[model samples]
Target: MPLFEYRCMKCNHDFEELVAATGRTKVVCPNCGATSVEKLHSVFAARADASPIPVPAGGGCGRCGDPAGPCGM
Candidate 1:
């Protein structure tokens, strides 16, 4: 359970929080509760001109899960 992206430096208010582990965790700024929170460097991006989810070459496709088949890279 790790999802934490917070930026509310007293009211800049951007949020996402579901963290169960990370040292000294006391992040609080649900729009102006303001523990002066700032931890924002989250990244997940995929669309460098992307189109490939055709995904059926057998073997369940949980990222190269090869049960003796279809794990051809």
Candidate 2:
């Protein structure tokens, strides 16, 4: 089963669902118990075990303006 993201139109709640296959499938919102929901573009996260995350060139730390911050530029 593949996990997919969805947003409830009735209550405006966002959730994830384990879908069988890609198609017009009915999904219920767990928060609002509404059947009216819309599929959303899922953003997946990856585990970088010991590997350094690449930082864009010249674009100082995204958070603090310091270049030598935790998010090294």
Candidate 3:
């Protein structure tokens, strides 16, 4: 399941719901019980503990000297 954000037009309420991806877009407002709700784009967070592999400045594989950089890595 993915979390979706919604805003109620009638009551101007904002909330988030855990819903199925194929579920209906028609959501009821919890504050006023209004069906006039607009689905919102949700933001997500990600974390990376590992550093990115550095690309050679010469534009090629530093170790094997492949011009395309090891099949573009």
Candidate 4:
């Protein structure tokens, strides 16, 4: 299954739904119960680097509670 983003053209409502990849699925707006919808481009995350982003001294590394961050124990 894949998640899809849709906007209701009739009601202007935004919502997400999980659908089967094999066939066409009917999408309906939860807000107004309308079948008129437009699929929106989905955005995804990709790591540019393996290392965690660095935080300056005294700025806590949110993950490990370190004041200076390189994310290493």
Task: Indicate which candidate wins on lDDT.
Answer: 4
Best TM-score among the predictions, by candidate number: 4
Model 4: C-alpha RMSD to truth? 6.6
If both were scored by TM-score, which would come out higher, candidate 3 or candidate 4? 4
Give, for candidate 3, the lowest lDDT window spanning 10 residues: 43-52
Give a tens-digit lDDT track for model 1, residues 1-73.
6676779987798897776665766879877787888778442222322544334556454446655654435
The TM-score, computed over Cα atoms with residue i paired to residue i, of candidate 4 is: 0.55
Candidate 2 residue-wise lDDT, 2-73, digit = tens: 677899999899999877775756789999789988888553422233455455577556456667744742
Candidate 3 versus truth, CA RMSD in Å, comes to 6.6
**Candidate 3 per-residue lDDT over residues 1-73, each given as its tens digit:** 7677889999889988777678566679989999988878553321122434345887766656777774433
lDDT score for residue 20 of model 2: 74
Off by over 4 Å in 1: 1-3, 7-12, 15-24, 29-33, 36-73
lDDT leaderboard ranking: 4, 2, 3, 1
Model 3: residues with Cα > 4 Å off, grouped in runs: 45-73
Candidate 3 pairs with clashing backbones: none
Model 4 agreement with the true structure over 32-70: per-residue lDDT tens digits:
999999988452222324455766667767667776555
Enumerate residue pairs that collide in model 1: none
lDDT of 1: 0.65
Model 4 residue runs over 4 Å out of place are 43-73
Instruction: Tell me the lDDT of model 1 at 34.
Output: 76
lDDT of 4 at 36: 91
Per-model TM against the reference: 0.25, 0.51, 0.53, 0.55
Give the higher-TM-score candidate: 1 or 2.
2
